[model samples]
Target chain A: MNARKRLQFGVAVAALMLAGAAGAAPVKVGMITTLSGGGAGLGIDTRDGFMLALKQAGDAASEVELLVEDDQQKPDIAVQIADKMIQSDQVDLLTGIVWSNLAMAVVPAATAQGKFYLSTNAAPSALAGAGCDPKYFAVSYQNDNMHEAAGAYAKKAGIGKVFIMAPNYPAGQDSLTGFKRFYDGEITNEVYTQVGQTDYAAEIAQIRNSGADAVFFFLPGGMGIAFMKQYAESGVDIPLIGPAFSFSQDILPAAGDAALGVMNGANWSKDLDNPANATFVEGFETEYGRLPSLYAAQGYDTANLLLSAMSKADITDADAFRAALAEADFDSVRGKFSFGPNQHPIQDFYIREVVKEGDVLTNKIVEPVLTDHADAYAADCKM
Target chain B: MLLVAEQALNGLQYGMMLFLMAAGLTLVFGVMGLINLAHGSLYMVGAFACAWIAAATGWFWLGLLASLIAAAAAGALIEILVIRRLYSRDHLDQVLATFALILVFSEGTRWLFGSFPLYLSLPPALTGAVTLPGGLQYPLFRLVIILVGGAVAVGLWLMITRTRLGIRIRAGEADREMIAALGVDISRLYTIVFALGAALAGLAGALVGSIQSVQVGMGEPVLILAFVTVVIGGIGSIKGALIGALLVGMTDTLGKALLPGVLARFMDASSANTIGASLASMLIYILMAVVLILRPQGLFGARA
Candidate 1:
């Protein structure tokens, strides 16, 4: 062999040994979450929760570097951030997205390119079933899981002639269908309003006139705040049921006393009695000076999941990392959290009633509607 | 019949709010010949000002007063510092500049008061529901809004036709150079007009704040609808704005309430709902289009 060729080979070997001896590189997690704009409340909580978990990870904090960027709740902007994170920053893991629509836009693309995306909040149905990707995992429940729990609760409560409403969009459609999946009661009416609509006076009037015994709606964020305010003023005095998103701790203050006595379904609540959850809730409330919502719980859990897997296997080794992640060994804030076959949570969903605790509006866990509840779509997922 | 009555009241209340926004927008567009996209920001600023002050002072009336004052001050400052230069410029420049101001106002508001929305409650005197003629129950605050809009409309008509300032405003709208030649201080007139328009918008925002969550981007959606109302009405006509707002508001409210129920008589429930919802959202736009098709300008648009 030529002398120069032998030297080049030797140098390459030395560099490889040096890299191997240094161990795996630090995991770069790029969070493309909503930080500013209308839904910033949810995104801000998610970011705070995720960062808290990482900060409390002790030695694991050194093993991860988070690059947070605000998507401003725009899908096109989310796509751009995802592409840049994948191509430019070359993040090892992508997490902490807030909305389902934004998730549907970026998740498939990010996972298709072989980047692991552990979702903190969004759990679109397509991702849980037919469109499920091996590299993607939802640390949160399926988008419909909580709504289904609400339906189950309504059925148990014998709510007949139910009037339902949601925004006219994919998530909204999913919410209605999910409610109907478990609910066999006679439906008086089902209405869909415009997405991002802030007024519901007309709809409230119809609900008043429909002769329905109960009302269920899936409007989230600002939409929920508007509906609840108007509903209170209309003096309809009907039973109001909804998914937890509308009555979440993050938005409950804005909804005011209007949300009092609203029954919602969710997998986690601040009052959940568990060691991990107690630690998370206390740590979070201490750090952020506010109660962590379901969004925040999901974000904190996502980070802990990544940290747990990182502790087991080097992130550079894709096969080993996937196996470690699928093991689901992390202590989740939502107790008894485990991955379904589709990498979505097979966890308990409880009925939470919004009640005033010492003049502060918050949710209290009423009953466990579904224990170790796996999504209906999990069976449809071949993976 | 009861449903119709209730929906109509809702439409009127919504239309009144729209008029409050559209009137100022049309007035600025007519007199200054400048498209002020940031009119909505003024609305948001007013809402925030009201919410912030109300929360601090614990009095709804005081908050409302401060919101109007703050909005007028903001409008006057913008006219002096930024808007005056764009007075002679084209509509595109005005649109671009005002659009930029929306971002500035939104971001600045966010910087001052974080991204979370603020809640404003109705005054204790006007908080409950009132029963109408046909056993239809409505919020008193909303009824007040409808009445306030009507009073403002009548007041606007009187001011424009009877008062000297109103004559100057009308004259300024007719011809800027001619008004200036007739010994009118054109710049001061523009500032007064701008501030008046802004104050109306602020009042609308403060009034609506009790019903709606006050946030930074709250103004943009209302602004778009205001622009739609302005187009539907004659661009420079207050009477046109009033009529157009009512028409749009009625179409939207009644369509949303009635369409799904009507469609369900023909199709299955869910599909009927899907189509009804889609159409309900587009109903106002469709009305606008029909108005434009029938009258190349608008229902009350002046022929060039």
Candidate 2:
């Protein structure tokens, strides 16, 4: 009750207030995905991965306020979501996009605003190359990395000639260009169908006539199912191959016996043997009541990577957070990962085959395609 | 040669499927004088019902039957409950109202089916491929689609031209009040016409679903294309629908298939590739615009 004692108590209370403001304020992060359309499964999985990673971190993430939005798979809407998140939410970071076009549309705007954009999916090559910016970091591998791995695997398997197909879109072109990077053999035919096209009989006939040893494609979502069914019915002797997105767990159930024996390359499969991955797979299944796709895995990793950066940055400093993300010093379910110079992930790629494992359908890893394969266009990025 | 034949047949089958969808949209517009943007929702419903029932019953045929019935029933219900309110409204209001229906139906279906797509397989009878002359093999299911589409076209033509209901429908199109004054029970006729349109859409959905994943919103993009088809063919003309559907489908398929090759012959591969892809994608839309310019009303439109 002395004047000196009262002044000391007031100073102590002021110090406590400053410390609480510095360490306890939540790190607000914004995420956007397609939660209401044809691509909803991918979006839902991404959301699950993100939230699961947060759950695993427990109360530690209580200091992180994650704001999520559904883009409805529209590019314009994605841009709007990105804008709203940055301006209204005042988010410190941004992540989550399943489609390449949506990512391409949103990433640049986020980066221009000096916000860190950690892409969970939509690793469009432009973003890896000329479009690359320091503020943008991909939590997933570059869009073409998996396809390039597929091509390399096919060459390793001694495949002489392949027929390739994809939707006639920017991403579809990326799929072919990536495959051709490592595939030195002859391409008997390269076909690009309409984006939402359902019929594949003509393409199947063309492939059969082309006399290719195998067929590689980049038809994701409903397009994949249609092509596989038609390919099966067409009696094309060629084996089918692609990245896991076209025919993974989201698609395999629909593909059924037709997709059996199809080869795919990916960064994560349910059959990956890493302990961190195993825990993730089990936890994801327990939480979501379904197998997690690569999209989900990437989304989950984005959150973990953000956390790693947040811890390194003490949760507030922008420049330090950006540096920590670029360092990518995090234990991921995809195992240890680091970012290459372009802020695109330099990670392992695995060759996997569609197979029925007990009562469940999943991809079983066949072999490692590459260890930390840096994307081809990283030099073009200059970032 | 046989390969070309097969491709052309495939194109024709696809065109016929387009006709079924376009027919429903055109009929609803022509008769009701209302824009129904949720027609595709009915198509989605048909596919989902077919897929769900097929899985539950282990019968593709039964599923097809159920899809048609379900789609038609849904069409009637929607007409009575929602569409009837907008009959006298402006086209823009009708468009907005139906657009809202699209949101409700799409969300409702997603809630029921979850996000994962459902696969509907062909029956064993339609699974095999028969070798055509010149050593080209074609899937039986595609041939069946062509056959079924053709049969529907013929059956539709007969029903419209040869039946008592057909006369009333044509009369209603010319003068709605006149048909009503003649005691033709206009409300019942509207419901029947709407149901008929819905049935065609359902059949198209079921057929296409066997080939594609039956997923929510799958019918939307196609529905837009169907509208383009009717507009190009001449709204209120079944004959125009067939012509427009085939023309649109072939132009779309063939332009996409051949554009890159043609461009590659004259230009550098990369430039040709880029230009060809863009042009190929835009071919049908370009065709639509040209038709609109040339005919104004449409190539087959009946100028009132």
Name the best candidate (by lDDT). Answer: 1
State the TM-score of the second chain for every model. 0.96, 0.95
Candidate 2's displacement at residue A200, Å, is: 3.2
Which pairs clash (backbone N, Cα, C closer than 3 Å) in model 2?
Answer: none
- The TM-score that candidate 2 achieves is 0.90
TM-score of chain A of each: 0.93, 0.91
Give the per-residue lDDT of model 2 (tens digit) for A115-232: 8888888888888899889889888888888899999999999999998887766677788899999999999877777665677776776787788888898887667777777877
Specify the CAPRI tier of model 2.
acceptable
Q: In candidate 2 chain B, where is summed lDDT lowest over 10 consecutive residues? A: B268-277
The C-alpha stretches of model 2 lying farther than 4 A from their native spots are A1-25, B82-93, B114-116, B267-274, B277-304
What are the lDDT scores of the predictions, listed in order?
A: 0.88, 0.83
* lDDT of candidate 1 over A175-287, digit per residue (tens): 98889998999988878877667778888888989999889999877788888888888878888999999898877887778788889999999999999999999999899
